[model samples]
Every structure is written in structure tokens, then in C-alpha cells.
Target: MNSNHPPTPRTLPTAAAADVPTFGCVVYISTLPDGRKKGRVANLDGIEHTAGTEREVLQRIVPVFKKRVSECLAAGDSVPWIDPILEIDPQEQKRFLPVHL
Candidate 1:
């Protein structure tokens, strides 16, 4: 085979992929009518939580996301979402998908 081209990247099994801990969920923030910022953190399983302020929402939702994941696992529910993290594997690209600032 010719060596001019780069090698094809290999795919790792979902389990085998190296996980790098990072923000796992997408938090949607908006200015409320009263000017307070509101946020909704959502995961792949359709689990979501709402809170006021970016700091507070993240603090609250991350734990809740973990709890939800645990519950989903305990019940033998297929984890619908990737574990919350930045996922450092070169195979994985980009943290959370685009979210409006």
C-alpha cells in the first residue's frame, strides 16, 4: 500500500474510550423577564433541571445528572447519554454541542 495518506483512525468501543472528566451536560441559559438568568441543564436521556444563575444551575444540575445516571444504571436502563465529561480521547471532538451564549 502507498504511504502517502494518513492512517485511518480507529474507533474505540464506548466502554473502551478514555474518559476525561469535563462538563457533561449542555446548560441552556436565558435572561428571564425580571432580568435574572435562568438555566436548564439537559442530558441525552431527556433528564433536565432548571435553576437560576449559571453557577447555581451547574452546581445543582451536575449532582442531579449524576444521580439520574446512577438511577438509570441501577434500573438496567440503557445509559442514553455519554458520561458527563470533556472526553479527552482524540477520537472525540468538541465538548457540548453548540449552545447560544
Candidate 2:
């Protein structure tokens, strides 16, 4: 992770459906100094999952992200989307995932 350069975004695989509403989600995974991996979703505040590995963190966060999106939709609140590029930290790795709810 070079602090001088932005991390390249990687797209995660997803199953598609023409009728399902899909939203673009940016997930940032970073390694802490203490060796823990932390995952966070862009535009979503105070929601983070930390684990011993990247896969574990991601697995833990995705369901929560989906649930939040579902809740917002059911409540008639607009789900916020932010450009992941603008939120990028050079030290963190990013994943672009299509979230279907």
C-alpha cells in the first residue's frame, strides 16, 4: 500500500437479476497496525466490521450492509451513494460490489 498512489478498485462477483434493484457499494478493507482487518462501506457511517482476515471482515459486513439498505427502503428514506474514488485512502484496498435487495 503506497500512500502516494490510490488503491485500485476490484469488482466482486454477484448473481444478477433483471428485476432486482441493485446498488453499487464500495467496501474498503484496511489492515490495522495491530494485525486486524477492518472493513467499511462508503457513505454508511458508524458501521464497520473487523476480523483477523480480509475475507472474514467482508463476510461479516455484507449482510449488515444489505440489512441497512433494506431498512432504509422500507422506511422510505433515500439510500445515499458516494463516489468511492473520492473516499479512497491510499493505504486501503477497495472492492466494488453490486448490492441487490
Candidate 3:
């Protein structure tokens, strides 16, 4: 399998993305085995930023994401309105919201 793309094409509702002019793309954050936090926003052209914490990694990716988007637009590429999607995995539903059932 090509490592260039993610295992799955994560997505979100178009309306949700349209609501925010600058849609929140999928920034996959994971805890590295070394204990350092890694934040990767593939929609931003395969960018992967690592820092001590998720917050710090986010701080680093924001500006970069904006810059890459701007460049894509300037180059006449379609607005990456759909690339970086905000999707919630079913398995992670509990982590996001607990249900009393």
C-alpha cells in the first residue's frame, strides 16, 4: 500500500465544512512511542509536525496549514475544502461523548 495517503479517506458533511470558511481539516494526532506527541495534517500536503504536546503541535500546524492552502489557491488548484475533513470514528464515540445506556 502506498504510504502517501491514509488507510481510509476520512470525510465530513459538506455543510459542516461550508459553515467555517476555513474548514477544520483532519489533523491526526498520535502519541509516539518515544513519548513525544505527533500531529499530522495530511490535507496540508503531507505535513507532520511533532512537539511535546498536542497543543504545541496544533500551534505549529495552524500557520502551515493556512500557508499551504493559500499556495494551492494561488496556483489555481481547487480549494481544498474537502481534503481535511472532521470525522468522528465510531470506536471513538465514547471518548467524545459518553452515553447513558
Candidate 4:
């Protein structure tokens, strides 16, 4: 992998008054065409599956998230500080994300 594009660590937990971590990451998942779905955990692109069910998609994603979290902890990756993504409407997928890019 290019050093310039390392996988991002998902949102970190909130810090305590002292001796607490101040970094984190975020993961986004959405359904796709023809019973397919996709997502990103940290910077790692997720697997595409044709489960055709929301519960199946969730089942597929759990392991991906867990593995990435382990990697992030081992690497001590810093989560970028930013406003949280508050709105996630599946209907407006194109507008919600930069599909062209």
C-alpha cells in the first residue's frame, strides 16, 4: 500500500480529564444495487456481498469492523478530529457521498 494512503482508524473514544485517549475513527455502510451492499471501515474498503438482506449485510460487516479495530489499536493510529457525520439517508446516497470522485 502507498504510504500516503494508510487505512484510517475508526473513531476513538472520548478522553477523560486525564490519562485518556483523544483519537478515533468512523465507519460508513450503505446498501447497493441488486441486493448488494458496501462500506468502509477506517480506510479499508469493505467487501461487496449479494446477501439481499439488511441483517445479512450487518452480519458480514461485524468481522470487518473488529479486524480493523484490532489493527488500529496495534498501530496506534490517530483519528482525525472532525464534526461527526450526523445524517445518513440511504435514499439520497449520491448526494450524501461524492459518487463522482
lDDT of 1 at 56: 69
Preferred candidate (lDDT higher): 1 or 3: 3
Identify the leading candidate in terms of lDDT. 2
lDDT of 2 by residue, 29-80 (tens): 8999999999888767656889999899878887888888889899999866
Off by over 4 Å in 2: 1-18, 83-86
Please write out the lDDT profile of model 4 over residues 21-55, one tens digit for every residue. 32233445566676565543333344333456655
Kindly report the root-mean-square deviation of model 4 from the true structure over all alpha carbons: 19.0
Ranking by TM-score: 2, 3, 1, 4
Tens digits of per-residue lDDT, candidate 3, 1-101, equal: 99897798778766543332444455767777888887766444566689998789877877777777667767989755544344534322111111111
Assess candidate 1 and give its lDDT. 0.53
TM-score for predicted model 3 compared with the true structure: 0.54
Q: What is each predicted model's overall lDDT from 0 to 1?
A: 0.53, 0.80, 0.60, 0.46
lDDT-wise, the better of 2 and 3 is 2
Q: What digit string (tens of lDDT, one per residue) describes model 1 on residues 1-101?
A: 56998889898776755643343466555556765555554445444434566566556656766666666667989657645622243322222433211
CA-RMSD of model 2: 16.2
Candidate 3 lDDT for residue 56: 90
